[model samples]
Target: MIVITALLIVVVLTLAIYLFYHHQCRLREMAFLMGEAVRNGDFTFRMPRKRMFFGERALLKTLNDMENNIGRLTAQNEVESWEKLTRVLTHEINNATTPILSICQSYLASPSIKSSPYREGIEAIHDTTSSLNIFVDSYRKMTQIQKPDPVELNLLDFVSGVACMYPSVQWHIDISSAQTLFIDTNLLRQAFINIVKNAIEAGARNIGVRWNRQLCISNDGAPIAPENARNIFVPFFTTKSHGSGIGLPLSRQVLMMQGYDLSLAQMPQIGFHVTFIVSSTCGSC
Candidate 1:
């Protein structure tokens, strides 16, 4: 009876050890597969939750985080490629259109050319050329996005400078702090100019600019919807018919490259507002 009991104990211990070793092997294999996927740029790969074992949950979580980061980087690369393609196409079209415009202008200015019965045709040609120029200019601006070099700037002074540039529009800037912020001065100015111009085009008699340091959150404590807000950072989205939709996106891109965050919000009481947040520590700026 004692011998039988001892044999039973030995068999149970052996089975437990085998099961433990098998689980460890499976965990290691999973880790290896996830690493391979990451190396291959396969961010879509996901580890099965049921397969995760003790001491492997953290590894799985890290892999998932890595996958998410890779996905974002891939998306950004795609956007940049598309932007480059659009820029090339616009440049080609502009080159063709510019000479045509100059020829039309020269013909219209000629005294003998105006005296002919084709005068009406010349006028129509001029009108069409002017319209086409405007169209091409809009498209050109949309495609050629400039990267900005950021510096420490006084928000109040910058706003005042922009306001002076456009005397016809009203500019109201409010800031809680007089602290200097690191920003791409030129790009920041351009962004402000674009937003202010949009406001003017929208017939907004009163344009308000406010700056604050806070996390962007909705009234319900959720992240704001990039879609409804027009996500100015996204390329090729414009609210205006004549707009190339590149201004805000370009501006936001510049700011982001300089390590800042830009956002837009619409409140029932406040209308539409543009906000900027600078990093606590300046990096590439």
Candidate 2:
């Protein structure tokens, strides 16, 4: 009777183990299906809610909420970006056109001024048209970023190469040998150049590149005002006298396309900081 009781206990344990394994397999299958749906842009397709263990139920709910959040955020960002772009473009075009119109009307209204004196108005129109062309070309460049072709790179080499481009400024590099990342070399180089130039223009005496968990480029320059910092990422928003203001915004767009993030921060210590976020779970980044 004791042996029979022992055998019965063993049988019960085996049955429980098999049930747990089956449940795990189901979970994995569900996860895969959910992933596929998300990849295919089927946000409306949701997993069936059913009575399950607390852990599994909670996990599924979390995933559902994530899908909804992502969808909302993506839509909101697109709308905001386009709205900002439109505002900047309209303002720039009006600035260019208004001057040209006023100058031309004045030139035409004065028939006696059709002599060589009118040549000044013609020159003004030419200058304004040239400036407008330049603005349009810059806008095109901002909107039409080429698809990035990424390659693995050593952090030290990449940062050093960019720093070397600006020999006039002092550079402080602190990166580990093991710190490597994958990025589009050409595109990232452009972004880095823009930031370096911006720092130099901001009167930075020394620039520092450091790699802890994420990459940070800092400059010993005056901190940006709270108001300016808020609009720093907006296209055509610049405090510089001659700044076209597309540099930072375009750099950010390029980085975002490559599944990375860039942002400006003012550290308590001193100087302006730009953070490059590299996510561990972002396989493409």
Instruction: Evaluate all candidate structures by whole-model CA lDDT and list the values in order.
Output: 0.60, 0.70
Q: What is the lDDT of residue 159 in candidate 1?
A: 71
Per residue, candidate 2 scores C-alpha lDDT tens digits across 91-193 of 6886767777676667756767666676676767767776775667667676567999999978898988887788988988889977887888888888788
Each prediction's TM-score versus the true structure:
0.48, 0.60
Indicate which candidate wins on lDDT: 2
**lDDT for predicted candidate 2 compared with the true structure:** 0.70
Per-residue lDDT tens digits for candidate 1, residues 25-46, read: 8877877987886675545455
Candidate 2 deviant stretches above 4 angstroms: 1-80, 83-118, 266-285
